[model samples]
Target: MMNINEHLLRTFEARPGEFLSGEELSATLQVSRTAIWKHIERLRQEGYEFEAVSRKGYRLVAKPDKLDVEAVLGRLHTRVLGRSIHYMNEVDSTNNVARELVQQGAQEGTLVVAEQQLAGRGRLGRKWHSPKGKGLWMTLILKPRIPLHFTPQLTLLVAVALCRSLRQITSLPIGIKWPNDLLIDGKKISGILLESSAEEENLNYVVAGVGIGVNLLPDDYPDDELRAKATSLAIEAGHTMDRSEILVAFLQELESLYDIYHEQGFGPIKLLWEALSVSLNRPVTCQTPKGLAEGTSLGIDESGALIVKLQDGTVTKWYSGDIQFSS
Candidate 1:
């Protein structure tokens, strides 16, 4: 059963540029003519433009390129993930809002998407570049049944999903660098920040913060220093991308891979992650709380640890770290 907004939007989409009278819309939606007008006004607030005549009801004059929840919802094919979505024009951080939603009893697969983030972040407290309408800034809430220690595997799994989706949508050579930084042509394009809460023993929930540089130009970077190390979908694809398309594809892939992870375990996901990793066999250094360890990357274990052969002829698995590659 589709909601009224969805039904109304679909009707307008099916008959693009055609005018439907108030009586027609009211009959089709089984609502009063005034109700239709209210819905149209709400959509206008969401950045949809409409043309109204004396007799003709309304016509969609133009659709804003801003984030459209209905656009994403119409194309979403996932079972659990992204079933409920909240869209914002700008947020301090999607993760912050998502954590609040979780505390307010937001269900699993609930998503918070923003067109821009004021305080966007990456792993290790790094500031993520998210300009207005130039990136996908979102936080997905999850309550996976997996144990606390193995929760890190979700980061790798999401990387695989994102890699497959971006490749399918934009045909970009996206690969995962270590835990969850997405790269193309050896420059960063996306990053994932995972935050979770736990009870005395069991895990409570996880908030996966994802930022994808969609249509950012070279000027969106905070400084020349970051511009040399990061790229965007528009830059790599040579044109502006339909951010909603990428969003739907990402959610679908994530849900599919997430299901596989819960049913079959991390072995299969680890293989897919390794296949898309760019850090394997590279000279890398991991900065843990203990200290920094430099080694050759040997890929990740089932527990999502980076297996490394240290500089002193010893092997170590780092569960958490800031990874940097040696050029």
Candidate 2:
């Protein structure tokens, strides 16, 4: 069945900046003019701006700065990733929901998104700040057939995808801080967390949790610690941007990158990740499960491990850890 709202949107999108007459839309959608008017009002409440004429029709003046499932889907053009979407007003965490869905046999490309995450978490169990209608809190479920040990490389792939998408949408000097936290002008603007369930050497499922500070204001991070380290696109761009558009762009980029990784391997992904890394050749201290390894960052190795040249001229590889840099 044709969706009434999507049908109406397609008409406006097909013309873009031109008006779609009420009579034409009614006939095409097989609905009454009154029903069309109600749908327009519903979209208006969701942040879309429509210019209605007495006898002419309605025009899509602007889209809202919020994340709407239909809005994101309309802009998405991906073979995989974001084929199915689960949107919520609030949740404990999109990652948690994605995990549950995967257990219930959710397929790859399934997505879970929430406007706010009450128990949002980051790497090393850090609490992510997710207030209502402020940021992008979502997770992607992937059922990659790659070896279980290579799953961490997906984090780098996600970072590269996000970097490409953000670069196209805004003019901010975004850089990938080693691993997958995105930084704009030295402050963290986004982060990626990876979780997977696997057997000894085989693969199962992977969940890539992504939290982005989009259209957020200074007051959004009330905590002094977060206020000093975090920033939003709206705060840096001097204005708010449409979160839905950015989400669609990200999914498209991710889909492309994921295809590349599966077919061409991690060589291409590592090159792009290294080119955009801010930690290379910089002094750093990584706190791994073993202990602290302080050294100069030598970039990542083929297996996606951080190569650090310690002070004693010994080089060590870190697969999982928290990276701390010196000023």
Model 2 ranges off by over 4 Å: 1-65, 289-291
lDDT of 2 by residue, 1-327 (tens): 658887788888888898888898889888999999999998887667999997888999997545778978877888889989999878999999999999999999999999889999999888998987888999999998799888888999999999989989997889998889999878999999999999899889999999999977887786888888999999999998888888999999999989999999999999999998887898999877767778998989877889999989999888777787875
Error of 2 at 140 (Å): 0.6
Q: Per-residue lDDT tens digits of candidate 1, residues 1-327?
A: 998877888999999999989899999999999999899998888778889998766898887668778888999988889999999998999999999999999999999999889999888888888888888999999999988888889989888999999999998888899889899988999999999899865789999999999998998888999999999999998999988999999999999999988999998999999999998998998778778778898989988889999889899898877789985
In candidate 1, how many Å is residue 176 off? 0.5
Q: What stretches of model 1 exceed 4 Å from their correct place?
A: 1-64
Clashing pairs in 2: none
Name the 10 consecutive residues with the lowest summed lDDT in model 1. 285-294
TM-score of each: 0.81, 0.80
Q: After the best TM-score superposition of candidate 2, give how far the Cα of residue 117 lies from its true spot, in angstroms.
A: 0.5
Candidate 2: residue 58 Cα off by (Å): 24
lDDT of 1: 0.90
Predict model 2's lDDT versus the native.
Answer: 0.89
